[model samples]
Target: MIIADLHPGLPFFLGALVVLVTPLRYRWIPLLLTPLLGFINLMGWELGTTTELTFLGFTLNPVRVDRLSYLFGILFHIAAFLGILFSLHLKDRMQHIAGLCYAGSAIGAVFAGDLLTLFIFWELLALTSSLLIFARREPRAFRSGTRYLIFQVGSGVLLLAGTIVYFNDSSSLLFEHIGLTSTAGWLIFLAFGIKSAFPLLHNWLTDAYPEATPTGTVFLSAFTTKVAVYALARGFPGTELLIYIGVTMTCFPIFYAVIENDLRRVLAYSMINQIGFMICGIGIGTELAINGAISHAFNDVIFKSLLMMTMGAVLFRTGKINGSDLGGLYKSMPKTAAFCLIGAASISAFPLFSGFVSKSMVMAAALEEGYHWVWIGLLFASAGVFHHAGIKIPFFAFFSHDAGIRVKEAPTNMLFAMGLAALLCIGIGSYPWILYDLLPFPVSYLPFDNTHVIAQLQLLFFSALAFVWLKLSGIYPPELRSINLDFEWVYRKLVPTQFSNLVSAYQRFAEIAHRLWVYSSRRLEVAGRRLHGPDGQLSKTWMTGSMIVIVLLTLSAVLLKNLL
Candidate 1:
């Protein structure tokens, strides 16, 4: 049987069983094994084995492997392996197990031949991934995890509903080539939109990412949104709406990241911005653009994970992730500083960095597709990326003002994880063809052309110049002592206050209405008692039974005469 013919259900079922049975001390072993198994199943997989099986009258594919699916599945396994390795030191088997199952489900969804299978794995990802946040056990973590779960599971529901509509309309369950005009397609798009961090649906990312455990954040960064991006590329490629949405997504978050206090949260905004690039690539819809998107997705998972790992290590060691509280850490943590700088430079698209290779492909595709304005917007966002992630993250945390606090370097495992990710970042950057060859389409694009390289260098240098100029002028927003309100404030603060005020007004109205009702009830009861009283006109029976009998006899006689 082809690798595509291998059943995903077996792995998912076995993974959950192993997770349940495996002892806590050795849980990482099984966690590590599961992804290996998935990787084995994914590598060298033959395309187009879209088989359907009916279990208790519910159809499931068990195997739906294709080129697009294989790309996502392979990366998800890589992410899972790295994530498990990164978290091996932690004692939380619950998180480890949940994360494995979550990764498995994401891989499963990618290979799902039909919407039903997709929805199953889709909900599973939400359920399992939320456990990572809840692993912290803080009240804030609990609340944020709950909110995150609601949005995630709600997205799955929308997908399922869309699937039902799709099947009803087309009499087919296959999940392929959905359009925006149909209800099913629109629902599915919105479902993907939520997880993909489309515009207003993005607050959960920035809200909950910072609240997760240091290791948990690394896992959080890789899988969920990127899987959604893959799904969009799979199910709704070339949807024009994504172009506008992607541009908006790219531009808005820079300001937020610039003004934000928390370093992890800053990365979260930057993540959304990067997703916008991929979305734009998908929207452009050429073979080259799609390949660029898929290639970028692969590179993004590596470098983004590396960046989060560095920040996670920072939080793990110093217990300070806020920009205002952290600085001058290179004195003690040179390795961490070095890894962080690599991650920053990679994200900033520095020459011979991973981002430069993949990001340029997307930009080139955009320009080639005649999206001149979008290309310009993407260029600005590129500079802004350098400003926030490149300059703000590393400079403030590692080399800026000395806060007079000395912390040890990250633990051995943390450094190992960061090193692994950094190696991939540099390896991919130095040789773009290594990634380009793995794209869904034949590789015709070159990221190292003179024009592209010169443009990128100019952009990076200019952005750096801007950062230095602002710093020298003392005009850059100083690290704040307070948390600037983000989109979450709408739900966390503004809505709650407004809801309380509305409830108070309703309570006042209810009190007045209650008094009126009680008064009216009491008056009616009094009226009833008075009407039923013996002294009342209706209650006073005059002449009693004798008068009633005489009246009956007279009426009977008059009726008889009229009948005659």
Candidate 2:
């Protein structure tokens, strides 16, 4: 059998089983090697008829390696490898197994040739990724994992419901663009929106990610949301509503990120903000715009995971992830600090950074599509991303006041992982053509125009200058060990508190009713005893005789009146 003929994701599932059965000391062997095999298989397939399976009268395509899916598959495979390298020191077999399965499911989802197959892999992605949270083996992590699983599985449920409805209506289950012209399409759109973290449905990303284990957070940061992005780009392109929704997602997260004390949570909020740009590009639905969204997704997975891994290293070393408790770490972990700066610059879209190359595509599309108001919103969001994700994260974690916390550099394995991600950010940014070539569409946009570069620099530099001014003038909000409420307040705090209050009210009403019942019963007993008890005059013989004499007098009076 030609190895190239195997499904790209088959290697991961097979590898996960092997990792589970392998001895503890040897488990990393499968962890380190599977992605390479997966990548090899991924690259070997041509553009058509890769693999398929027939199940229950549905023509399920397990492998359809088109340009669009291929780009995502390659990116995911690379991310899986880097993730494995990052966790090489870990002996937790469950995490390794779950991580591999999670990666495999994501690959399967991307390459799935039909809605039915995609949904199958989509649900698997949720199941396997949630296990990563549980592998942390902490009570808080367990709770977060449970909540995360709800949002995830909920999305899959919606997809399944939508799929049923769609099949009933159209008698087809192709995973192509099903626009919002019918109920089925709308359900699927909402399902995609939930996973994409669109506005009100978004708290899951920020709520559960920080509570995961450090390494788990790195994997958590990369795959799930981006997969949603892929689905949206494919399914809801030019849907118009996405543009407004994306704008809202972009602007809302920055405020929460600014006030957030947990550095990991800050990154989580920033993840939504980054996705907003992609959503907007998809909304534009032009070749250039869609290209921008895909390339940005690619860039986001790398840099976002890089920052997450860096923070994971910090948490691993210091046993703290809050910004209020961390500072001056550059003194000890210079390598990590440097790598973090690269990730920051890349995220900030500084010239010759990966973000600079990709994000520009979206902004330019917004302008060319006559979305001037939307363009303005995106520009402001761009600066806001730099303010919080780019500046706030690094400044507070590495360069703020000396907190007297000293720790060694990140582990060699971790440093290796971070190095790989950092290199990609710089590499892709410096040479846009290499990434552009991988885009689903041919490259037409240029990143290095004198006018465009100058404007971007001015915008970013001014944003940085504003941050410095605020810090020096004592206007910037100080990081505090306090929770900043977001949409999660609706569920985590408000709903629970309201339910508790309702229970209290019910108890009070029940107490009052019980007392009233007792009082009424006592009154009835007293009244009954006064009328018929043995001590009463009416109950005795004298009362009977008195009643007879009164009846005789009444009869005599009635006879006299009749005679008159």
Candidate 3:
């Protein structure tokens, strides 16, 4: 019997169903096994469209196994596994099921060769991932989850509208590069940009990710934005505007990272900065640049998740994650601290680290593309990331003055998750070729050249020195409980408050109008009583002569009309 290649999403989605129905005692088996199954199935895919369907005269390829899609499939599968491992100790079935479904949707989206199929998976991603946020069950989680849902679902709506318009205009459903030369394409691009967390559309990520349950944050940090990156790289590679937009993404987040009080929120800002690098690389679109973009994305999932896992550990242990509220954790949770440092160094792009290999490719590509200024901005961003994510995160949480709070080490499962992530960070860095070999394009770029190493070290060390100087001079911004304003203020604060005021005004107007209506009705009732009620005109007796005269006139008019 010939075995057919399975859809990359099947393991995750089917596993989710099994998880939902299986007895609690045996529920964990599927979580542990699902990603492996997905990975195995992904490896079996044979480099082209594998499954197709025709309905209503539309050709839909449910499985399109190309380099770009395949790469993303691998990443999603791996992420699902790590996410499951990290959450192993939790008893929340909703999280397990929702997270699996979310991963499945992302995997499914990548394999979709037609817009319709991609749209289905795209919306599923939004729905299932949002559940991770709501699973926290806190009121704050609920509110943030709602905002997250609105933005994400809104993106899906745009995607569907754009797809329909594009299909109508072009009479093609093949997913390929469609630059912003037409209405449909621009709509689709904007939809992708929103998911990618382009500058103004970015607040949802920082706002929502920090509010998610710890394990949920790990999953959130991995899939949603990366899918956008994949879509962009897939659908609009070499678009020149992305370079400028990507630069903006890189340069602006550093300021927020420096001042943000919530440590997880700082990581959120840092994520945007890192994604900026990838976007810029994708914009370049040289083989090297595209490889850089894809590899950096891969590297980011591991290190960023590691960082989130550590913060989650701290949150899990002491019930605090704010920099202002946490300190001296290395004293108790040394293993976690070490793992966090590895993640930190990797993110910082230190020599012989995962980030060092992938990020260098992008920087080198930027220079090669004659985007000299863009390269400079990315260079600055590199240092800024280290300043915030690499140094500030570990320093404030682990090495700073003790908060006098002592806690036990993270649970075994959490430690295992961190350890696995840490191993990947080291493994990828030590052997860059493992990741390089998997790049969607052939690799010619080298990250370990003497010039590259020296230049990166100088930039990173100088940035570290600035941090030290600022700290010694007492000029570094201290973590504050009061929130700083961001683009989200327009939605999270200003819009809601404005809407509340508008509603109050409307309610007051309704009250006044209601009172006027009541008064008018009373006056009309009084008039009726005076004129036509029991004691009024119609009820009173009239003189017989007057009544007869009236009746005679009425009869005369009627007789005249009939004669005419």
TM-score of each: 0.90, 0.95, 0.91
Off by over 4 Å in 3: 1-4, 507-564
lDDT of 2 at 339: 91
Could you tell me the lDDT of residue 83 within candidate 2? 90
Candidate 2: tens digits of C-alpha lDDT, residues 251-311: 9899999999999999999999999999999998999999999999999999999999989
The superposed Cα distance between candidate 1 and the true structure at residue 205, in angstroms, equals 0.9
* Clash pairs (backbone) in predicted model 1: none
Write model 1 residue lDDT over 323-400, tens digit each, in one string: 999999999888988998999999998879999887887888888889999989998999999999999999989989
Q: Which of the predicted structures, 1 or 2, would earn the higher lDDT when compared with the native?
A: 2
Clashes of each: 0, 0, 0
What is the C-alpha local distance difference test score of each model?
A: 0.85, 0.91, 0.91
Instruction: Determine which window of 10 residues in candidate 3 has minimal summed lDDT.
Output: 1-10
| Model 3 lDDT per residue over 1-564, tens place | 022367778778889898999887887788899898778777777876558799788988888888888888888887888889999888899999999999999999988888889899999999999999999999999999999999999999999999999999999887889888989999899889989999999999999999999899999999999999999998889999999999999999989999998999999999999999989988998999999999999999999999999999999899898999988999999999999999999999998889999999999999988999999999889989999999999999998989988899999989999999999999999899988877898998778888998999999999999999999999998888867899999987799999999999999999999999999999999999999998998879899999999999999999999999
Give the residue spans of candidate 1 off by over 4 A: 1-16, 56-59, 517-564
